[model samples]
Target: MNKVIIDEDIVLKGEHLSIVFGGLKAVEDFNIEIKKGELVGLIGPNGAGKTTAFNLLTGVYKPTSGNIYLNGTNVSRLSPHKRVAKGIARTFQNIRLFKKLSVLDNVKIACNSNMKYSPLTAIFRLPNFWKEEKELDRKAKDILAVFGLNEVEEEYAVNLPYGKQRKLEIARAIATDPKIILLDEPAAGMNPTETEELMETIKIVKEKYDVSILLIEHDMKLVMGICERIIVLNYGKIIASGIPEEIQSNKTVITAYLGEEVE
Candidate 1:
């Protein structure tokens, strides 16, 4: 039998997670846990089902078998938005932003769900509506300031540089007030400098927001540099898992993903 969640520190847990399509098992027997404020890396070769596992965790794909618990609650059946409301948020492999919207508006949209004013109040510009709107504006700008995007808050999201766009996606995700964040290839298509900047951004966010993070990335430097623990996946199963040094030295991980020591 799968163990019950006895540890209160575990923010997210996946129990024997498996997903299948047709005759293929995209992810199999996946079990993992992320504790509060921990940064974990999921690394794998192409088609190793890293993203599939993320999809299962984020409610994009319902698992064929298993359970997902968020802070001790069984959330396996929640919808994506419901999951977000329950403090699980995620960024996609491809940056998904409201491209035509201003950066502030993008972040504000995510914060809107937390607003309690009804449509009638909003349409009539009631006192409660203005109060919530003013609070959301402040909160959105505060999130923007954390990402150093406050000056560009009025700029359309599409007009920002590639790096800022990545940051904005994360900022929008943060606006949802998630307990844990799933980052899907946050550094994809970035130059080394941008990657380094992102590393700092992630570090700052973790410290500032105190949220657990699970990241999927092909970038060894970023993974090894920031992750407290690393999990290697191959053929839809975990091949190795440990701290960065141990993962770097593990023969299975080296053969499967790293191919050699990262540094």
Candidate 2:
């Protein structure tokens, strides 16, 4: 992939990104650019390489070929935590939380990279350690409030309901103070009411945090309702991309989902 100058408005860009696992090409030539504060959706039939593409972007899996740029810097080789520090944050398709930790602690942990106190200060509980801890506590609670999780801030994460657990995971990602967030199927397993609530929550997150979002969701209603633009993938490649209305009418996308050729 040739290097291209990134626009200031582009928070994240992936260029000709491809990944091969063993003998299989999971994702090939996937390219995307997410603008500041934009909400974009990625949709495809199962096993269409959506998650693989996300992994490549978030540094969970390094691309076999191509480059990932944050702002204008090449971050294709950065580790997952390094990527997070550099303004990329992601949540898994499955909820991965510290089951035993309180909801507040879970969010505070994501903010660890931002803490300035030295290890010695923390080990001895110095004045600066308490000062930073107090600030993080206030910050975590504020984030939890956005998700309607403030009331449960002291509860263990494993005790929250399925929907609340999903919310908590998102809240934790936001705690990283990211430039962009990649959400993997945030609506999976949610009932209609929960899904609706989730849609609103996502909107609030974007507006309140000023963060760009790239969402992977199977729920067409949620996608069409909130996403400004949509990208459709089939057989590990993007087949169509445009505004939601254009994607809804695309012949290639229709065929990919229904498994029948369209005239």
Candidate 1 local lDDT, 1-263, one digit each (tens): 33454588999999999999898888999999999999999998888899999999989999999999888888898898888998999999999999999999999999998889999999999999999999999999999999999999999999999999999999999999999999999999999999999989998999999999999989887799999999989889998999999988888877775453342
In model 2, the Cα lDDT at residue 130 comes to 96
What TM-scores do the predictions have?
A: 0.95, 0.97
Candidate No. with top lDDT: 2
Give per-residue CA lDDT, model 2, range 1-263, as digits (tens). 43457698999999999989898989999999999999999999999999999999999898989999998788987898988998999999999999999999999998877999999999999999999999999999999999999999999999999999999999999999999999999989999999999999999999999999999999877899999999988888999999999999999898888893331
Native-to-model Cα distance after best TM-score fit, residue 128 in candidate 2, in Å: 0.2
Report the C-alpha displacement of residue 260, candidate 1, in angstroms: 12
> What ranges in model 2 sit over 4 Å off?
1-4, 260-263
Quote the positional error of residue 212 for candidate 1 in Å. Answer: 0.5
Task: Name the lDDT of candidate 2.
Answer: 0.93
Off by over 4 Å in 1: 1-5, 258-263
Worst 10 residues of 2 by lDDT: 254-263
Best candidate according to TM-score: 2
RMSD of each: 2.9, 2.4
